[model samples]
Target chain A: MTGTSFIFWIVALLTVGSAAGVVFSKNLIYSAIALLFSLLGVAGLYVFLWADFIAVTQILIYVGGILVLIIFGIMLTHRITNVQLSHSSIQRGVGGVIVLVIFAGLSAMILNAPWHRSPAIEPLETVREIGRMLMINYLLPFEVASILLLAALMGAALLSRKTD
Target chain B: MVDLNTYLIIGAILFSLGMFGVITRRNGVAVLMGVELILNAANVNFVAFARFGGMDLTGHVFSLFVIILAAAEAAVALAIILNIFNNLGTVNIDEANQLKQ
Candidate 1:
């Protein structure tokens, strides 16, 4: 195995393991911490894919912004230190079976699909290109996304305000 | 060189794990975390495809938009969850069934 493949395996394992921790941990705080690791691992994977711009954005937006928001949400709404939020399973047997079946199907489809692979694997400098495209080709969507974020901010602030 | 299948399989597993978490966990925040996992899984697929299948930057742009959407969705969802906690005194979805009555 080459060095890139080895790095891929390490990052993938870290991501999946931490994601499992996020899922199975009974404590909400522990889950949030695990989610931090998982998001970091994903950022690492994005680097592996040569998406430096997206990798930085992933770290900036996800790790910096969303994870902090989630942690704050956990802290603000409940008893922080003493709260042992039980991750009670509603239908464990059924859920496990359904998940396994969906995974099997997805894996089968992915493996069987004839994906077109490009032979030339040149290291791409994507940051400038992504920025240019966002302003040029994707200008409409970019503007729309900003509007959506603004709306979401207002809605969230409105919803979480204390009502007397 | 790591094959494309490797990334695809990883995405599939992550999606499945997210699905399991969403189905089984009762806590509203945990379920939201699961939904984030699912979104990450889709982002992985999009980036991997853009890297391997075509040299286009469309998938990368799409993933960026998805990340923004996930952030917005998380904010709104968490705010709603907090509202539920305030009104219902709990974040369990099964117990927060005022509409079912």
Candidate 2:
């Protein structure tokens, strides 16, 4: 009916559709490409939520950083001459049945929950606010995350070292 | 106008699909992709609740942390997968399990 909802519908469809592509595609390369679109669609949802900064970060870290890393993993692991990158799946029947049950339960809970919601919508200075909070209220976690990043960096390098 | 329920439902779908991918995919990298999807779904729900539940910017900060942690996790996980591929010659989880023999 309105512009935002219309945009929301389009984004939601794009996200879900591309996510399906990621799950169902037999080709690993195609799944990676589909994941790119799905990540972009999610950024669009963040836009609708007025989380402009997070949307940008999602594109940066997810699309720019993580997706590239995944692509490299795919390329490095496989012999890339014919590019016949087949990603085989297993136990589909059991997985499908389990997912369906979980989804049904989640949908029912979401639909029935008497959520106490407040529509106090205001455009946020998300970047500035988050920056200040990181330095002040969340200083401990901020420092910890940085340390974690450092540890992860070193650990990854160590794990991927040449065995020779 | 878009509401909280809408986001929650979408998150549910993404989460379920991600779960299915994780369950059925044998390739290690594909499984990582599924994990990314599940993380994205949680990030969406966090942002939505922050916006609509009167929490202001808390959810943004939380999702930022999630993003940071996800980056770290992906880096480490991919490194492990590459090592697995190097030693085992395949990234299939089912195949790499018989390491004791």
lDDT digits (tens) for residues B17-63 of candidate 2: 99999999999999999999999999999999988897769899999
Residues B7-80, candidate 1: write the lDDT tens digits.
89889988998999999999888898899899999999999998898578888999999999999999999999
- DockQ, prediction 2: 0.89
**Model 1, A25: alpha-carbon shift in Å?**
1.3
Summarize candidate 1's per-residue lDDT along A60-110 as a digit string, tens digits.
999999999998887776776667855566898999999999999999999
Q: Pick by lDDT: which candidate is best?
A: 2
iRMSD of prediction 2: 0.7
lDDT for residue B68 in candidate 1, whole number 0-100: 98
Worst 10 residues of 1 chain B by lDDT: B50-59
